[model samples]
Target: MDMLLGVVVMLVKMAVVLGVALGLAAYMILLERKLLGRFQVRYGPNRVGYFGLLQPLADGLKMLLKEDIIPDGVDRRIFLVAPAVVAGTALAAFAVVPFGDGLTLFGHRVPQVVVDSNVGLLLVLALSSLAVYGLALGAWTSDNKYSLLGGIRGAAQMISYELALGLSLVPVVMHARSLSLSDIVAAQAGLPFALLEPVAFVIFIIGSLAETKRVPFDLPEAENELQAGFHTEYSGMRFALFFVGEYVNMVLLGAVTAIFFLGGWHGPFLPPIVWLALKVLAVPVFLIWTRASLPRLRYDQLMALGWKVLIPLALLNILVTGALLAAGV
Candidate 1:
């Protein structure tokens, strides 16, 4: 009976987490548009509903009702599968993210996390790395020159930045002494890793910007050059899936940043869940602000920044952290 009960609970948690991820993804588009407009001195989507609150619902409905088109000579199977791969990986990575302290209901205590796996941090990195395949495959299968270039750029950029992104986490693991995200959060009860390892914190944020292909790092999908980049050939629901993948990735980066650096759900006074939600929302807004503020870098500059700057900085941080640990600092 305990086994059955556990299975049921897991299902419930999965359902809730998925619902939240998709729901937030749909609304994140609205939030980004709204914020981007404000940053550019304009009103955004205020017509769809009061204060534009119903815009996401309208947009989702439109996507569901649109016709899905397949370009000629494309690999139909991969074309269809790619977006799912991207969206699925983004949603799945949230499994190990803890949002609040455990709570007791009906005499049973339950963790706020979906899966408190010991290797949750590693799982997140692996899944993030996997998401790029969707971009590459979708672009390649589209058989469009624009998309093909996008695929090449996307793959190279992500692969290059991923090294720094992964390396930046070494200090977090060193400080926390655990790979589990929950354990890492608990380790920050007194002080967050961001304060302890600012170098890694900065490197992680910059690497994350590149990883998500945001703003200055968004060379793969440079609209002026690549004409919608990897998803240029995608239409209707397929395009919507890619859109979901990007927004969900933004949320994932925000959550991971909070969990590893800002002390996940660690603020005082407010509820833990509220604290996490605020932090999660903050990162996306910052990304939008960046999109408004920065110009896209030249492709060479993007590659050089990731490989020459972030990678070296992350390695130096790891060495310094190791030395500090050895010196009992």
Candidate 2:
């Protein structure tokens, strides 16, 4: 009975998390467009609903209703499955993310996260790595040279930055002395890892932006050059899935950053869930600000920054952290 109850609870949590994630992803598009417009001195979508609040809904409806076009010579089966792979993997990464502390309701205790695995960090990294497969497969199967080039660039960029991303978190893991994200959050009750490992924090942020293919690290989807990049051949809802996956990834990365460095759900005065939400929201805003201000780097410059700069700095951070630990600091 206890096992059955646990299964039911898990299903409920999964439903809630997925619903909230997808909803937030849809609205985040609206938010990004509005913010970008404001940054560029213009008004964004304000037609459909009050201040264009229903713009995402209208956009989603349009995608659902549009004809899904499969380019001639494309591999149909792989093409059909690619967007699902991207969207699914992005959503799955949230399983181990703790949004708040445990809560009790009706005399039942429940964890705030979907899965509180001891190796949650490893699972996150693994899922993130798998996302590249979707991009590569989609681009290759499309049989378009532009798509192929974009996919190759994306795969190379992600692989290069992933080293820095993983290494950047080493200090956090070492400081927390646990791979479990919940324990890591708990460890920051007094002081967040950001204060102790600011270098890692910066590296992780840059790496995450690259991972999500945001501007300045968005060479893969350089619309001006590659003509929409890897997903150039995608249309209708299939295209929408890729777009949604990016926003979902942005939110997840923000949440991960918050959990790792900003003391997840640990702020005073406000509710824990509210604190977590604010922290998560702050990251995407910063990312949008960056997108508005920074020019996309040249491909060579991008690769150099990731490999020559971020990786070496992350390694140095790990070494320094280790030395400090060894010295009992």
Candidate 3:
């Protein structure tokens, strides 16, 4: 009976977390639209409902009701399953993200995270890297040349940037000396890694933007050449899943930046979660601002930047960090 009760409780908690995170991902799209509207001197999503608060819900409902179109001659099975894989992997990656130190619930002490693995940081990295597989499979299975091209570009881009991303973190791992995110946070209790590792932080930020496939690096979705890219043939809820997965990825990357560099849940005069949220949200806003301001890079330029510029910079950052740590300076 006790075991059954524990299982039920775990299931309930998992459901709530998944529900809330997915809902939040939906609204983040709406939030971006409304904010960008203000930036562009126009109102956004105001027509849907009450100051546009309900816009995401309406959009979600519309997608749900829309037809699930399977393009003729496509690999139907993978096409049907790819979006779920992407969205599910993205959400499942959040299980190790620590929301707070701990909380009191029904007089029981419980950790805010679903699973706090010893190698939580590595888990996050592995899951993110694996997401590219879903994209590759989806594009290939779609039987569209454009989608195939986008998928190839995306794979190459992610592969190139992920090296920089991983290298950029060597300093953090060196400083923290642990793969657990909690340990990383604890190491930064007084001083954030951003202060000590500014150059690597910048590299990481750039690499992260690439990893998330944001504008300026959104070569996969280059409309002129690839149409809608990997999901060009998808529509309605399936498309919505891909959309939500991308934004959720943004949130995840931002959270990682906060936790590893900016001092996760560390601040004055406010709760840890609040501080964490504020820091993490800043990354996505910066991304949106970049989208509104900067133009996308040419494919060759994108590849050149990753290979010629970011990779070397990230390696140098790692070396410098190693020197600093050795000098104990």
Candidate 4:
């Protein structure tokens, strides 16, 4: 009975998480369309569902009904698996994110997370980094020059930004003096790290946008230049997988940022889950705002900023944080 109960509970939680993530990713597409429309002084996605509420559903149906096209002479296996791998990695990264207070289920104290290792933060980082493999595979397997170029550019860009992204967390790890994400949150019980490590927070957010290949850093899929970039030849549900993965990744990054800098599940007046929702929503808005305000940097310029500006600043922030901690100041 206990074993059956555990299985049932796990399945339920998995269903809930995936359902919420899929729904959120779908709406995120609409949110971007609507918000970016306002920014550009236009109405967006108003043709489907009331106020475009059904736009995502329409889009999903379109993607599902569209023929799945596999490029001629392409590596069939890898091409088919690439998007799935990316989406899986993106979803898996959420395992350690505490959604809300622990819930009592079947007389067991079950936390919202699927797994809560001592190195939860490190695990999340590692999983996020691995998501790049999907992009690389999708591009390489397509056997097109443009796809190859986009894949190479995407891989190179992610590598450059990931270093800064990882380094920016050094200060948080240093201050919290621990790696477990829950401990990090506990350290910020009174005040958030964004207040202390402002520079690191800034670097992390910038690096995150780059990591996710958002606008102003979306050189990989610069449609005007790369013909839709890495997944250029992909169509139908395969292409939809890539699209879903992108928004899911955006949500994952936002969740990580919330836990690290903004204080995970920490707030007053509203419940913890509500606070998390508000924080996660802020990320895409910021991304869209950046897209509306800034121009994409040259590829070389983007790499240079990651290596020269963000990295050094991240390191310096760590140094200062360490010194202050040492001096008890």
User: What's model 2's lDDT at 136?
Assistant: 93
Please give the range of 10 consecutive residues that has the lowest summed lDDT in model 4.
93-102
Model 1 worst lDDT run, 10 consecutive residues: 99-108
Best by lDDT: 2
| Candidate 1 residue pairs that clash | none
Per-residue lDDT tens digits for candidate 4, residues 269-292, read: 998889889998898789878988
Q: Where in model 4 is the C-alpha error above 4 Å?
A: 1-3
Ranking by TM-score: 2, 1, 4, 3
lDDT of each: 0.91, 0.94, 0.87, 0.88
TM-score of each: 0.98, 0.98, 0.95, 0.96
Per-residue lDDT over 1-329 for candidate 3, one digit per residue giving the tens place of the 0 to 100 score? 65776677678768877887787688789879988998899988897778988888888889999999898988899888988877888898888887777777666677777787889988988888988888888898999999999889889999999988998898899999999888899899899999989988999999988988998999988998899898888888998888888988988887889998999998999988899989988988898888888889999999999899988988888888888889988
lDDT of 3 at 78: 89
In model 3, how large is the Cα lDDT of residue 303? 90
Residues 202-266, model 1: lDDT tens digits: 99999899988999898879999999999999989899998899899999988999999999999
